[model samples]
Target: MNWIWISGVAFLLSFLAAGVLIFFGKELEDLGITGNIYYIILIPLGFSSAAFLAGAMKSYASFTSNESVSYGKLQLTGPIVIFALVVGGGFIMPNFNRKEQFDVKMRIVSNDRPMTTLNEGTVTLYIGKEPKTVNIHDGEVAFYNIPEKYHNRKVRIVPAINSYQLADSNEVLISKNEDYVDIHVTRTKESLSTLVRGSVLDQKNMAVVHALLDFSSGLATCYTDPNGNFSLTVPLPPGEKAQLKVVTDGITRFNEVVTISSTIPIDLRIDKTP
Candidate 1:
């Protein structure tokens, strides 16, 4: 009776899950994003396994109540079969990242006092031996599913701003884990810092200290020290040029377009003339 009750509940839940996924699939298709078949079936697989476990737990109580050994064994065998399938199927699944794939996505951030959000970056994933690139955007990025043949194999995920400094994570063992692998990548300030430094001098070539430097929109500002040396940090948007505005005596001094493509200091000379 317990087995019947658990199985009944499991079947209902699995059925509802399948229906919801199927509904979402149509919506996704309407949105023009490709859908995967596994998305709908995996729910049933998981819930059915859970149902078996529930039955086994209920049957254990029957053991002390004169329940037959054979019946208990039968109850246990159901779960064992599901577990075997989950474990065995990990290696036997023919489809991996091939066609009809799912999205593998993650967020990108910087390790700072308050944590800076990295809006754009790129990562690479190896499905089996095949490598694929995923473009990052607005704090998250994804690579659409891989070739199906690599579905049950060990997958490699790597992130590198430059091809020469690529870093790899331990190969992800994907069996019955899920249809997608979400990965998070963090970049230290050392990896993305751009130091802007220069000496603010006056007409006499003397130091013009305490001069104000502003980036467009006044998003960032820095001031020259007594020695006319100023150091500022402004992360130029990836792959773009930005302007730096300096103000002296309520007048615009230097408004120059600069490119910061590396983790190096950009030098500037600000001299005021009468």
Candidate 2:
């Protein structure tokens, strides 16, 4: 459910409940005198009105902002409050500077397969001089866009990854295991330390970190080379996890499942196993 809609509904319900109690309950009338019914009704109405007005003011402030707000008194939260007020105050403020204030480029590439380089094609929109496009050797579209812009400025092509999705309204039920059991596997090598110095000292059997993926299941099989080496060039499989066994002769064994991602190197070593 949308939080904003939920909040609005909850506020409306509370206001209605307060109104009902004031009108039907004798306790409310007994607490006050005759002709004071107006006061009773006005109090709640004033609260509701103030709440709505504050929300409106906040919304209005959000749209308006000055490069500077000159206020004599500065409180600890004055800047934050001013920011909130400008954002919520329902005003549109323009940024005066236009000299490449901030920018970002999205580069997409198929590391496993061949595709066109992102730099090869004509950038459809306001691509910078050296815009970073997906570095592909084949035919995969790569694009980016400014998340927020002052005007309807069209620039980088927005890719599927940049789009947002709203989940369905139906209640979702999910079950997951809270506890996990470790399995045993073996590996030949391990890194000496998490912060590895320049190179392993005098080690020929040293293994460079490499990832093996089970194509059928799309799970990553990661193990560190007792050699302490890793490769960042490998491509990630489009799967939820990796499934593989780690074992090495004359070395420790670890048979456990670990989450997989291309962003982090697979550096599990049997020697480090406790």
Candidate 3:
């Protein structure tokens, strides 16, 4: 009949009930409140429920602890009913809030294609209407801050990383109280339609066709034709003058920075190192 002992028992029962409701409460409905900030409410509710149960036990004991050890039924009922309500409500509030929520797990699929990483390694993530540019490593990313309010909403995701394009925008429908999303995206190189044609030559005026041409990250093993002439579609990033370095063994590296002023082949001559 000690109120302190009774309060401890109440706390234990409340903890157990909350655990069961959160983990296996599917029979009540898959409220999906297993892991969320809403659970923080249970902390204070547990203490309040235990305190109420303790007070009820003290009041009930006062009626019967007169050595006659007989407490009127009506005296017991009030405390018992209040204890039930307090503990019961504590377990339901989170579920009520969760009834509006769903979870999202997003993984950016790069179609198994290798990503050409730049200095700024980042992409844009669109959650509902909010857009955030998040850094990505290994082409994988995850987010857990979604609220239940975003449930059943249409979400469009796109990668804004430079040198890479999503190929197409990916749209996903947020369905269910828990949504596991696998975003299918094909990371293709951002397109450049312009072509640059040229020839590589040595000091002897010989075709340096086998010369290795380094154009940004995309290397072109440009070997000259029989006439010592080589041409390639330029893959250099646009909006700036691009340079191609001719890397040959032993000889000093030769290169030229040129803008394709015309569609006609721009003749390039790799002069000997001065």
- Measured by lDDT, the strongest candidate is 1
Candidate 1 regions with alpha-carbon error over 4 angstroms? 1-154, 159-192, 237-240, 261-267
Using lDDT as the measure, name the better of candidate 2 and candidate 3: 3
Q: Mind giving the per-residue lDDT tens digits that candidate 2 earns over 126-173?
A: 344643334322333323222333123434342222111112221111
Lowest summed-lDDT stretch of 10 residues in model 1?
57-66
Task: Say which candidate scores most in TM-score.
Answer: 3
Ranking by lDDT: 1, 3, 2
The TM-scores of all predictions, comma-separated, are 0.35, 0.21, 0.40
CA lDDT of 17 in candidate 1? 64
Reference-based lDDT, residue 172, model 3: 70
Off by over 4 Å in 3: 1-37, 52-57, 61-83, 93-101, 112-154, 173-274
Error of 1 at 250 (Å): 1.5
Worst 10 residues of 3 by lDDT: 28-37
Q: Please identify which of the two predictions, 1 or 2, would achieve the higher lDDT against the true structure.
A: 1
For candidate 3, lDDT tens digit of each residue in 105-148? Answer: 54455554444342345555576555745556555444444566
